[model samples]
Target: MPSSISVGREARKANRRLSPRAMFLREFFRRPVMVGSIIPSSNRTIRRVLDRVDWGNVRMFVEYGPGVGTFCQAVLDRLGPDGQYVAIDTNPDFVAYLRDTVRDPRFSVVQGSAEDVESIVADHGHESADYVLSGLPFSTLPPGVGDRIVAATRRVLRQDGAFLVYQFNPNVRNFLTPHFDHIDYEIEWWNVPPAQIWWAWKD
Candidate 1:
């Protein structure tokens, strides 16, 4: 019936269904513009991005494009008992994976655009998020989508809240500049491709 290559492809697809890394690679190939890297973020990058948050005062923490729950457990671990962690992603596969694997009452995964963060937060019974994390590839997003996401992110954050972003491209800074008065960044060289971590405050 099938050729060797065809069988290999099918076998890999099956493996992807069972393996998180394989699934992430599949999604990256399926949507390179949406996924920043084929490899998941490193633990060092996760710590650098998350350390920017003031966990004690955080009531709600929102995330954009949380591929394969990389930061979910970390956020949940640091979050207060009463805090909420809501993650939004356009990738159905990622949203589904997070929903199926992350079994925390405080976490909510929505298959949607990051631009709708404001309404999404409202829908979840929160007025504003204390911190929002995103690793979406802003430099690759479709025209106008990046602008909308940054603008809406600013609107959905509390007064002292910050937007935490880790990206391979430093160009994401351009998208953040107009919305945030204060922005700082560092490079986490320990990551696969080395990531630029940013903190854009809503001051």
Candidate 2:
């Protein structure tokens, strides 16, 4: 008989050792709310969660770890003319792809560090955003890096809005807890290996 294992577990393993291409596609799927790392092989579940949010009154949506622009496209499609989307990616390729591929006036693609999301958000003329979604790898970043990203998210997200993050590693929950009023998480058992999506919301 074959062993039956969860996809999340597989992703967790793959995450510990990701191929370059797998690393690339993982961005096709997720954004984390707390940390600042990208696992291109683990994003489908992240997208699934974002699709469930009620985006009606959301005028501005900011995405960290835009990666290859998977989440960026989703944000642009949902955010109407009245809605604006800004994506921050340190990868020049992803940032350039985002800028060239997505031409909507409501979309802005930036190449920058996830830790500086606050200034990025403010530079875009947003003091507080309706939503700040992230895909940064929180588990592997330096200690204060994850906290900084979360802090920036909190600084920008509106009182009634959300700060969503995805993590393959459960190691950073401590930092994630103090920054948000509510935190929600899920295990994606069907992805390449699988991953966890943690939504940190403050309202």
TM-score of each: 0.91, 0.76
Number of residue pairs clashing in candidate 2, backbone atoms closer than 3 angstroms, sequence gap of 3 or more or interchain: 23
For residues 34-56, what per-residue lDDT tens digits would candidate 1 score against the true structure? 98798999888888888878999
| Per-candidate RMSD, Å | 5.0, 11.3
Give the per-residue Cα lDDT of candidate 2 at 62: 84
Model 1 residue 65 lDDT score = 95
Kindly give the stretch of ten consecutive residues in candidate 2 with the minimal lDDT sum. 30-39
Residue ranges of candidate 2 with Cα displaced over 4 Å? 1-47
lDDT agreement of model 2 with the native: 0.69
lDDT of 2 at 121: 75
lDDT of each: 0.89, 0.69
